[model samples]
Target chain A: MARAATTSDVFNAVAEPRRREILTLLVVGELEVGAIVTALRLDQPSVSKHLRVLRETGLVHMRRNGRHKLYRTNAPALQPVHEWVSTFERYWSNQLSRIKERAEAKMKQSRETGTSEKES
Target chain B: MARAATTSDVFNAVAEPRRREILTLLVVGELEVGAIVTALRLDQPSVSKHLRVLRETGLVHMRRNGRHKLYRTNAPALQPVHEWVSTFERYWSNQLSRIKERAEAKMKQSRETGTSEKES
Candidate 1:
């Protein structure tokens, strides 16, 4: 089947935990199908199915190495996904900054009151 | 049905483009279901289905406002997703940096050669 060509396809493919785990594995380096199946503790067919989805999403690239098919992360294909999710970063970033500010305020209060409670 | 309680669930729910669009709409502020449906140009049932998925994933919060249920983005629920995808930022960031460097180099070469070609 032709690979997915939209944001939904990319997100849907990665929606499976197994697929995310596969991507993580590829992030470190390329691996043969056997290693991926073993790492995920899933049956060969199940792993293959997830790999097919990943391949369709362009999140992974597969190459035949002799008799084995090796899978690697297609870093470029992930750029769009990364960019898309980045729009939400401001929300998280604002929350994180708020958290930091609260922590700093607490620390300042502790310093003023001579309390030894550690503020994280 | 009870909401999903894993990373997979969140990713799966947001995987739909309609769901993401809903999120974008909610980001600015909360909206009534009718408004969302109209904005997306989808039927009420379809929009409702997407909303259910979003609500199940905890990416959206709905409250009854009079006879209508207003939907809004659950900012905290999206934190994990944002953090998860941010890991891949380094890959795109590196690529962007590489592109910038190449552009700079090309610009320098153009200057040296007295060419006026713009490099982006």
Candidate 2:
């Protein structure tokens, strides 16, 4: 068994890329520490450290299953991060929508032209 | 002027709370380093350090305005973060709507009950 990490806030806890990888892995389902280590191909100590950080930050929930400790992401705990990032979403969403609309229009025009040529 | 920070990815750069605060302050408009210092109520060097990090990460754009350096957020750079967080949106969005629907139904039920009592 590994010692748990001291408390960390969401922002500080997720600073490392490895931690993010751990999160993406956990999003699908729960896994034991060894399973997580295998999934991420990380060493035991480093994975343990990141898990501790995520646990302390409330980003992940842990439970004891007899011998192994199972870990799973608590998605709602990321609301603050989601809210913060959302502030700037308006800037990109409009541009992306415009880009999508243009692509759709072009595709529709090409399809229409193709059909007309086929008929001719 | 302070030296710029080395390049950082969005996740790592935003890990610091002060940096997020600095980002919020810059979201509205550009500001000089001194103005940021005053806005955040942080010391000159700490503000400079964060600015450097943001600049290096490409999360912020720095321009020269006479003698002062102007800083503004590059919102599109956060697309990756936005996309990553959005993955979990489905979980919350549905849950929130269900909660709202329940609350609204309760209010409607109470109104109907009140009207019936009044008629009786």
- Per-candidate TM-scores read 0.75, 0.76
Encode model 1's per-residue lDDT on A1-120: one tens digit a residue: 322333347776776677788888887788999998888899999888778878877888899999999999876776666676777778668888998999889888988998977745
Regions of candidate 1 where Cα sits further than 4 Å from its true position: A1-8, A105-120, B1-8, B95-120
Give me the overall lDDT of model 2: 0.79
Write the residue-wise lDDT of candidate 2 on A47-88 in tens digits: 998888888888899999999999988888778888999999
lDDT per residue as tens, model 2, B10-119: 87677677888888888789999999999889999999988888988888999998999999988888888878888877756778998889777777877877643222
Per-residue CA lDDT of candidate 1, range B8-48, in tens?
47776776677889998997788999999899899999888
**Top model by DockQ, which number?**
2
Candidate whose lDDT is highest = 2
Q: Rate the local accuracy (lDDT) of all candidates.
A: 0.78, 0.79
Instruction: Give interface RMSD (Å), model 2.
Output: 6.2
Model 2: what TM-score? 0.76
